[model samples]
Target: MEKRWLPLYGNNLEAHSTIENRSLTDLLNDTTAKYSDNTAITFYGKTWTYKELQKFSEALAASLNGDQFKKGDRLAIMLPNCPHYLFSLFGTFRAGGVVVQVNPMYVARELEYILNDSEATHIVILSDLYPLFKSVRDKVPTKKAIVVALKPGAEIELEANDCLFESYLKQATAPAPAITIEAENDLAVLQYTGGTTGVSKGVMLTHLNLVSNTEQTYDFMFSGEVSPPPNARIVNVLPLFHIFSLTCCNFVTIRHGGNQILIPRFDMPEVLETIKKEKPFQLGGVPTMYVGFNQVGKYKEFGLDLVESYVSGGSSLPVEALEAFERGTDRKLCEGYGLSEAAPVTHFNPSFQERKAGSVGIPLPNTDAKVVVETDAGWEEVAVGEVGEMIIKGPQVMKGYWRKPEETERTLRDGWLFTGDLAKMDEQGYFYIVDRKKDMILASGYNVYPREIEEVLYQHEGVQEVIVLGIPDPYRGETVKAYITPKPNSTLTSQEIIEFSRKQLAAYKVPKAIEFREELPKSAVGKLLKRKLRDEELAKVEAEQSS
Candidate 1:
C-alpha cells in the first residue's frame, strides 16, 4: 500500500527538519537576537522584552552554584502564569538542571507527593503558598532548599519563617559555572499526570523533544496562508504547568515573538475584561473553558466578536460546545489532541482550513500515527476506518516516566508510544478520537463511551457540567451513571437530566441513574476526576446493599 499524507501536515515536516539542526539554547539565542527589542512577555500590565527576559534568565541562572544547586539536580517550580514563573523555569533549564513543574493550586498533600516522588532538591514557590509548604516541608525529605516569589497583590507572610524569596535574590553572586548538556541526552522536564491504576508518574521531557514539538506546532498552525498574522496577541489562561500551555502558549509564543496577556486563573468576568482590553487573536483552553466562556451573559462585551482563532484541547471538545462558541464569537474552535508523554502535541487542526468538529486534525509534521488493534491472538495494525489504540512516534515523545522503567517499557514499545486513546481515521486522513480505553463502559454486554452520553447532556441548556461513569451493577457487572452540576440559578434534578439524555442517547448509553451536585471534584488543573466520582457511587451502592 502507498503511504498516505494528511492535508497541511507536509509543510511542517519540511520546517521541522531545519529546526532539528539547532540546540534549544541556540534557538532561544536566535529568537532573542532578532526580536530582542520586541516585547516577548506581558504579565500584570508589565512587559518584558526578549532582551530583558534573556538577561533576567541569565541572572537567575547565575545565582545558583555548589552551595545552592548543582548541574543535573531536580528543581521544581510551583507558581501561577506570572513573569517570575517563566523566568525561573527557563533559567533553571539554562542552568543545566531539570525543570519539574508543579501546579500552583496543589495542596500540602499534592505538593508533598510530587516533591517526594520527583526527589527534587530545590523548589521555587509563590509566597501565598508558604503556609502550605511549611505544613508539608517535613514530609518532603529530598527538598534541600526553597525560594519563594512574592505573590502579586498578596502580602508576604513567611518573613519569620526561614527563607524569604526577596532576600535570597539580593545576595546573588557571580554567574554559575557553565554546564554542557546534550540536546538528545539531557532530561529537560518532568511533568506529572495521573494513571489508570491510581498513582501519578512524572513524564520526562527532553530539550530536543520540546524544541521539535514547538517547531511542528508552529508549522502546522501557520501552514495554511504563507504568512502568519503580524503582532498576534494570545489570551493565555491555561496553567503554564500543563503541557498544552507550556508548548502552545508560553514557549511557542516566545519562539514567535507574540504578545501574551496572562490570566492567573480563569474567571469569566476577569477573562472578559482581558479580552476587551487586548482583543487577542487566539484563545486556548480545554472543553470546560469554552463551555463556561460561551455562557457568559455579556458575551458581546468581550470584543471576541472579531477573534481569529480558538484552540481546544486537554479534553474532548463537544460538537455542541463548538457550535455554541462559533455562534458567540463567529469563529470555529479548532480542536487538537495530545498527551503529556508526547511533549503534549501530536495533532492539531490546520489554522487555515474548514475543520471537522469531532476530529483532532492530523498527525503533526514528522509525526507518524498508526492504529494498534488488539485482537484475540495479539495486537496488529489496522487499516484506515478502524478504531483502536492510537500509536504515535515523533520528536515529541518523552524520554520515559521518571524512575519507572517497567511502566515506561509497557507504554513505549519499539518507537511508538501507545496512548491508550481509542480513535479512528477517515479516508480523507482526519482522525476522530472515540474515547479512552479505561473510560470505556461495558453495559449490557455492549461498549459505550461516557463522552458520547455526556455530550448529549451538555446539549441541555440547564446542564452546566456533567460526568458520566460506570457504576457497579450486580445485573450487568457495570452500568452507566451520570453525575451532573446544574447551571447557576436553575433547579435541575437528576431525573430531568436523565430524561433529557434519553432523548439523544441510545438506551444502553443513557444513564441508568443520575445524581446532582453543586460541583464535581476535579484535579488541580481542572480535569474531571471520574475515578473519584465512580468510587463514591460504588461506595454508596455497597453501603446501601449492606443496609
Candidate 2:
C-alpha cells in the first residue's frame, strides 16, 4: 500500500521516524532550563515566567507530597483556564500522580459521577464552585480539596479539613522529591469522554502518549509555513480542561517556550481588546470563537491582523468561518482534527503544504490512518475519497478507558483506535470529516450525547418517549433539539424542561429547543430510530438553507 501523503512531506517532516519516549514534565523542564526568564503564562493581572511557573509547580507538588499525595493518586482539577491549572497539572506530574480533567461547569449531579468514578481523592477547584462541590462532598471519595479564589477578597467557607490554595502553596516550597515515572506504562492523565451510551469513560493517557503527541504536533506545525521563534507570545483562550487545548495549546506552548495569554471565558469585546494589547503572534480557538470574531466584523480596528496564525479545533470549522477569516483578515484559518482517544490530535492541515479549506490534512509522523468499512467479511479498507470509519494506529494512541475493559475493547481493536467518526481520505491523503458515527452532538465545540439527555428526560414523568438530536444553527455549529412524546394528558413546555435540565446538567448539555411530538420515527421492531430523526432534521436544515 502506497502512503499517498508521503509525496507531500516537506524536507522537515519525515513520513516515518522514531518517536522519542519522554514524560510531560520535560515539556516544562527543557524549556525552563533554556528560557527561564521568558514569560510562560499570563492570566488576568498576574504573569509567570518559565522559572516562576516551574517554581509554582514544584511548590504545589511539595504541598501535595506533604499532604500524602502519593504516586498514581488521582487528582481531579475542576477549574477553568488560569495559572492555577498549569500549576495543578505539573504538580501532579511532578508528584507522579494522574491529573483528571473535569469541566468546571458541571452541575452537582454530573460532578458527583466523575469524582466518584475516577476515585479522585484530591481536587483543586475554584472558590466560586465551592458550594457545588460542598453539595456533593459527602457523595464523593475526595479526601482533600483546595479552593482557589480568583476574585480579590472573595470569601468561600471551607470544611475544617479543606484549605485555601494560598494556604496549600505555603507549604510547597521544598525540593521536589525523587519519584520514578514510567512514561510508557504509568498513567499521567484520565481524560473523561462520553461513551456511546452516554456513560462517562475516562481515557487513560500515559505520559509517553502525551509526550509523543506533543513532539509530533511541534514537528508537523513548526516544520511548516509557521516558523515562530522560541518564546513567541501566543493567544490561548480555549479552556485548558479540554484535550484539544490541553495538548495542542498548553503542552505545545510550554514546550515551545512561548508565553500564553489565558482567558477564563469568552467575551468578544474582552478578547478583541486582549488581541489589540497583547499582539500575540498566534491564536488557537474553536469555531464558535472564530465565529465570534466573524460576528464582530472589525478585523483592522481590533488588530485581528496582528496575529499571524489562527488555528481551529475542538469541532468542525464552518466553511463560512474560514471564508470570513480570509475576507476580513486575508489570513488562513487552519482547521485540525482529533479525538480524546488519540491524545486528542491526529491530523492538522499544514501551513507549508497545499492547504485545503475543508480537509484535515494528513496524519502526523508515524501515525497510520485508514478509512475502513465493516462488512460480513470483516473490516476492509475503503478506497480513497470514500466515506468510512476512520481508524488510526500510532504511538500517540491512549492505553485504554480507565477501569472499563468492555468499552476499551469496543474502541480499540488490535492496535488500532477505532474513531467512530465518518470521514474520507483524498488521494493525496488529506482527510475530511463528513459526520459522526455516534449520536454525539457538537454544540459550540462541546460534545452533547443524545442518550444522556434522553436518559434525563425519561426520568420526567411528563415524558413518555423522547429523542434528542442536533440541528443546524447559524451561531452554534449544532444546537440540540429534543423530540418528545408527552405522557397522555401531560403538558410539558420547552421552558419547563429547559429549566429542569439546567439544574441537573451542564448548560451546554441542556437542550436549546424542544418539540412535542405525537410519535417519533421508529423501525419495524418499534425501536426508536435516532438516525431517521437525524435525517429528518438534516432534511429540514437543507430545506431551510435552500429557501
282-377, model 1: which lDDT tens digit per residue? 888877677777667456777877677778877666677788788877776789989889998888777666588888987787788887787898
Worst 10 residues of 2 by lDDT: 15-24
Name model 1 segments beyond 4 Å from true: 1-3, 7-17, 21-23, 142-162, 226-231, 297-300, 376-378, 439-547
What CA root-mean-square deviation does each model show from the true structure? 10.8, 1.3
Q: Report the CA-based lDDT of candidate 1 relative to the real structure.
A: 0.75
Model 2 / residue 290 / CA error / Å: 1.4
Instruction: List TM-score per model, in order.
Output: 0.78, 0.98
Clashing pairs in 1: none
- Model 2, residue 71: distance off in Å is 0.7
